[model samples]
Target chain A: MSEIINSPLLWKGAVVTLQLTLYSAVLALILAFFFGLLGSSRHGWARAIGRFYVEFFRGLPALVLMFWFFYSLPLVGIRFETMVAGVLALGLNYGAYGAEVVRGSINAVPTAQYEATVALNMLPRQRMWRVLLPQAVPLMLPPFGNLLIELLKATAIVSLITISDLMFRAQQLRASTGKGTEVFLVVLVMYFVMAQILQLLIRYLERRSERILGRRPRRRAATAIAGTTGTGSLSGVGGEGS
Target chain B: MPSSDTMSEVPTPEDPQGAPMDKTAADGALPHGSTPGIRFEKVVKRFGDNIVLRELNFTVAPGERVTLIGPSGSGKTTILRLLMTLEKLDDGVIWIGDRPLWHMPRGDGLAPANEKHLHEMRKQVGMVFQQFNLFPNMNVLRNLIEGPVRVLGLSKDEAVERARELLDMVGLVDKIDAHPTQLSGGQQQRVAIARALAMQPKVLLLDEVTSALDPELVVGVQDLLRDIARASDLTLLCVTHEMHFAKDISDRVLMFDKGQIVEEGPPEQIFGEPTEQRTRDFLQAILAT
Candidate 1:
């Protein structure tokens, strides 16, 4: 247990794992927004292109994609480093899934919100940026959090591609120390810890968005305490008043 | 990505005629008791196989207050939606301030209006929905100021100042920083009204604005709207189930059934001395509940 905990090789592997997750996560997020917007675009060609990318990448398994990019592409004289290939595979794969999440979240914003923007005579760009995207973001957060955790777990597949990620280090430790159980348990705990951190980060973002959007009940609590603040009534003049 | 660049391709035949009218109808330029007149000529709208508005010919005078009353699915709300440019016209033309809405002039023929034309026409109109579609992502102040700041090109300070005035007019100045969810249904509706007014539109369309409010809350929104109507020369088109609100707000009441006007007259003639049996039936059916 002590050796597993103190192994410099394991620490190095963990650092590499963190780097891969961060880099690929960023890549996936950017592609998600790009393809997602295209998927929801009004243009026929843009939506078709978005659909093609999402379906093509999502149909292939991430490990197979890594192998193709790393091995098959080199045969055609188009080669990538092991880390680059792993990142591209993971990013493209998760990005396709994330694109669906983005599109769904944008659609989930009620039609009336769109109408409100139009009623205000907002340009299409203003409507999406100011009203649509801000509202869609909170809806996207929970699903995106799930995807992030999945991506963290999926990084283990990179170990098969000669990346010295945490799982790779664990395997080497198991072979040399002949203590598969101890080494694997430590690796499992490390993954769990990383997942928990991601969850915490996502939760913080969700709370912050709620605060900004006023979706949180903080104002309601305040309104209740302040009793007569919003109680102004218009009960006279027209017979329409209850 | 929707741009007005296509407008350059389409000849602005209405430009010569639309310019002067636009100047008078521009933000805060119209006289207190007059704005723009809306004319619909043979306008038709269909939802799938269901024809909603069939050869709908109607004209609203400048600063006139008109209420469209009909039973559910009579296409009363559809008329407001058309004017707001929320729904496309299946056939015919809609004129806002003497300019065609669904069509643009092109080489001695009417071409279907592009996104740019639709957007340009939209700025002249504002609408209040039954559900009070206030942007829940923004506070009352932000909601009121968003249109002015973004579309109207006012600075933040100027928009805020205008928003404060409008909120004070609607009596929600205290809740400027409060979220839509925190307010009551009536409060939210007021915010929606103020939000619409911040744009200073020439034509105001109210589509069942009070339908979603609590019974106790309906009066407040109605009262606020009544004050607004009396004070501004905005050409007002309203759709409502409330008979008294219809009577109070409308100078003329158009009773509709099956995509056509069954009867139209002063509120007194329509509600008190209805000439058409369908109008009486719709009134009785609405008032009974």
Candidate 2:
């Protein structure tokens, strides 16, 4: 375990894995929003296109998609670096799931909010950006946190595409040093720690969003409690004297 | 997209004389000296097989306070929805102060209104919904200021000044920073009223504005509305089941049944001596409850 941790090759591989996860996560988020809005559009054709993309990506396995992008695309004069191909495949696959999360969260916003926007005579753009999206964002975070962790774990498959991520480095170490048990155990612990940190970060974001969206009553209650504290001291003195 | 063809060809007439006077003269269909606050001409609306409103024709004169009373599913609320352009018309036209609400001029003819036309027409109207529809994401102050600042193009300071005045009027000056969920139902409805009034709409549609409030809270909301009706010349078209409220505020009361007006007259006459049997029976049924 100590040798594996100290090895430069494994450290380089860890950095590569981190880069892949970050790039793919951002791409997945953008696709999720785009497809989610398209799926919820009033036009049937837009909705159909969004649905087709979601089903196609979700039905195909992520590992197969990685291979298809890396291997098959070159035949059609389309090629990407192995890392880029891995990110694209992972992003597209997980984004399909994220789109469903976005769509469901947006729909869960109360109909009264839409009606209120209409009654105010706000333009459609104003309604969606200012009212609907802000309310939907908090609801979207928990599911998105789940998908993000899943995406982090799914990055393990990218080793098959020769991207030199953590799993890829672990396999090389196992082959050369014949220390399969120690190398695999370290890799497992690293992935679990990464997932735990990601969860803490997502939970922090969820709380911040809830505060901004006025879903949390903590601020109001804190103020009320402060107000009562001053009066309660005065009342306590009076009661003890009586 | 059918309306796209007319978009380029239709001249965007300048509102040189301002919206109110310009609207009446722009459309030459209305007879001289007959500028209605709202006009529904042969308007038809349906939901699948159920006809909500059928060839509904009515006019509320400028500054008139008109109330609609009817049983459930009698299409009273549909009238308010149509006027707000919340629902599209299946057939016919509606005019607000002589400007067609659902159509615009296109080369000596009328076509369905495009987005710009609809936005322009909607500026003249505001609605108070039964649910009080205050934005939960915004504080009471922001709720009142948002429309004026964004749509009316008021400066933030100017909008804040007006919002404060409105909050005072609604007796909720203390709730400027309170979120909607923190307020009582009565207080929320008051804020909704102030929010609509902040728009400075020439016409205000009330869709059972008091129905969602508790019985004790209903009186407070009703009283605020009564104060508003007495204070301004704002045209009001309200759908309500409150017979006493209808009697108090309406200059004219319309009784609707099965998507048509069964009877309409001065509130005193309609409440005291109805001429139609259906109107009498409906009134009796309501009064009993």
Interface RMSD of each: 3.8, 5.9
What local lDDT does model 2 show for residue B263? Answer: 75
Off by over 4 Å in 1: A218-242, B1-34
The per-model DockQ list reads 0.46, 0.32
Model 1, residue B81: C-alpha shift (Å): 0.7
DockQ of 2: 0.32
Flag clash pairs in model 2.
Answer: none
Report lDDT (Cα) of residue A225, candidate 2: 60
TM-score of chain B only, all predictions? 0.88, 0.87
lDDT of 2 by residue, B146-185 (tens): 9989888999999898888888877899999988877889
Q: Rate the local accuracy (lDDT) of all candidates.
A: 0.84, 0.82
RMSD of each: 9.2, 9.8
What local lDDT does model 2 show for residue A190? 83
Query: lDDT of model 1 at residue B128?
Result: 92
Would you give me the overall lDDT of model 1?
0.84
Q: Tens digits of per-residue lDDT for model 1 on B106-172?
A: 9998899998999888878989999999898888888988899888899999999888877777888
